[model samples]
Target: MTLPAFELVQPRSLRDAIDALAAAPGMEPIAGGTSLLVDLRGARVKAETLLDLGRIDELRGITIDSHELVIGAMATIADVLKNPAVAEHAPLLVEACRLFASPLVRNRATIGGNLAYASPAADAAPPLLALDAVVELRSVRGRRQVALAEFFKGVRKTARKPDELLVGIHIPRAVPGTLSAYRKLGLRKADSISVASVATRVVVDMAGRCQAARIALGAVAPVPLRVAKAEAALTRHGLTVEAAADAAKLAAEATSPIDDVRGTAAYRRRVTETLVKRALLELVEKGGDGR
Candidate 1:
């Protein structure tokens, strides 16, 4: 498929890029061009100008602050998987990256693009949401931070304005007893979109009680969701068999899946419950304290 004719602008700095986007009518930012190019060719997106973010050096890097791990928006899936800071502080995100796509696509797909695409099945959302990640948005006007939980407004929708560029993802450093796991139920293991997915994080105290719990699900709703009921169940019961059961049931009930080519609504609900239970059990089998 051929993309519609569009003016391509390559800017050396973030300021220049934002300037171009703000000046052009129907201009959209492109990073990696993995998702945007396809959308353009498929007529899913229309644009008269394309602002390429590749030359903007400020939009790339990985670092750790005293309180959190900061990953540049342009970082690729491979970059995240190999970053030592990411591996240590956000293992659930690393696990999600492992299941993202094939190597060829992963090399070209930026984390910012994945989140900006705002697909219900985006592999980046559930795990990052579980980690209580924050997204940094920048524009000619100024910069602002939005919680990942509040980033998505709906399907293919986000709080990001047309002039704003997603600059970074900030994830809090993992606590000592934090444990996290991610699982995606795709039709095939490689290069397939998830039919249903779950990511969970639990911080268990030395006394075997869950001090903090987060359970997030994707592809079964209009937006990626943190299942508060399920998290509460785990927090109250500390991942016991009964607690797992209650959490699973709540997760299944909370999902508003629809019949689609990937899966039936009933199938997704059932798998959601099973996967949530399995992930909690895996945490338990790993010695429960997340150490």
Candidate 2:
């Protein structure tokens, strides 16, 4: 199907993009056009104008500043895989990128577009959530930062206002002794959306005791979620098989899944429990080397 006719506006600067959004109703921002184009073609979404952000250089790089990794909203999945800063600061994000889609799609799919599309199965959200990432939103009024946990309001919905543009994502640099891992269970080995996914970050001391844990789940909830009960089960405890099992059970219990073409709620819950346990056990065995 062909996309509906719409006016395209290419803004040369970030400020110009913001102004365009503020001035026009029914103006939708387009980064890579990977998801938006498809939505438009299918008539799932409609817009009178397209605000192309590709030319705005301000929204297209990855940098580290003051102990945080700042990724420009326009950075593509391929860019994430290639950037040394991303690899060093957030390797689990790389894991997600590798599993995002085909190479062709990865090259054109911007990180901002992925998050903005707001799919429960979005590969980027779980890892970013586990890393305690924050998204920066800008508008004519001012700029505000929203925690990744609070970014997604519901299915295909986000906290971004109509006139606000997502400019960047900020992630705190992982501290020493922090181990992280990501797992996605897709129907196909490649190029398939997740049936259920899990990302984990565990901070452990040399004594093999857990100081902190963050377990984020995707595709099994209305939004990507950090299972606080599961994290609490592992926190301040020995990283033992028993603890992993208990935490896994809690994680599974927290999910609110629905029966979809890809999977049933029961299947998703079982996968979530298994993946969480496996990730925790792997972290314990590797002793902070979650490669």
Candidate 3:
């Protein structure tokens, strides 16, 4: 099917792009356009104007500061996979990127777009949430930083205003004794939607007791979510078999899954528990240090 006619506006700068978006009532921003183009062609999205963010060079790089690793909104999945900072500070994101779509899609799928689309199955969200990432939103008014956890309002919905554009993602540097992992279960090995996904970051002290833990899941709810109960169950507890089991059960209990074409709710819930269990066990085997 052919896409409907629309105006494509490429701004010379980020400020100009913001102005273009503000001028149009429901203009959509296009970075890689891998997902947005599909939505446009399928009529799942309607837009009269497309604010091209591609030309804005300010939105396309990776940098690290004393505080956090900053990934530009336009950085493609491939970019994330290649960045050494991402591997060091947030290996969970690197694992998620490896499972996100295919090489062709990853070469074009921007992380910002993945989060902005707010898909329940988005591979990027779980890892970012697990890493305690923050998303930066920019508009003519100014810029604001939002915790990734609070960014999503619901399925395909976010806290971003219509005129605001996602500019960067900031992931705090992992502590010295942190161990993290990400796993996604899909109907097929590749290019398939997730039935369930899990990302975990655990900080273990020298005595092998967990000091902090973050666990996020996807494809089991209206939005990607952190299982606080599961996290609490792990923290302060040694990564013992019983603690892992308890956390896995709580993770499954936290899910509000729905029956879908990819899999049934029961199957998703089961997979969720299994994935969390395996992730935790793997971390323990890796010496509870994300190396």
The digit string of per-residue lDDT tens for model 2 on 166-240 reads 999999988888888888999998888899999999888776668789999999999999999999988845567
Q: Whose TM-score is higher: candidate 1's or candidate 3's?
A: 3
Candidate 3, residues 107-163: lDDT per residue as tens digits?
999999999989898899999999999999998889999999999989889999998
Give the winner by lDDT: 1 or 2.
2
Top candidate by TM-score? 3
- Each model's C-alpha lDDT? 0.89, 0.90, 0.90
lDDT tens digits, residue span 124-184, model 1: 9999999999999988889999999999989889999888889999999999888888889
Model 1, position 245: C-alpha lDDT score = 83
Count of clashing residue pairs in every prediction: 0, 0, 1
How much lDDT does candidate 2 score? 0.90
- Give the residue spans of candidate 1 off by over 4 A: 289-291
Model 1 pairs whose backbones collide: none
Candidate 1 TM-score, C-alpha based: 0.96
Candidate 2 vs candidate 3, TM-score winner: 3
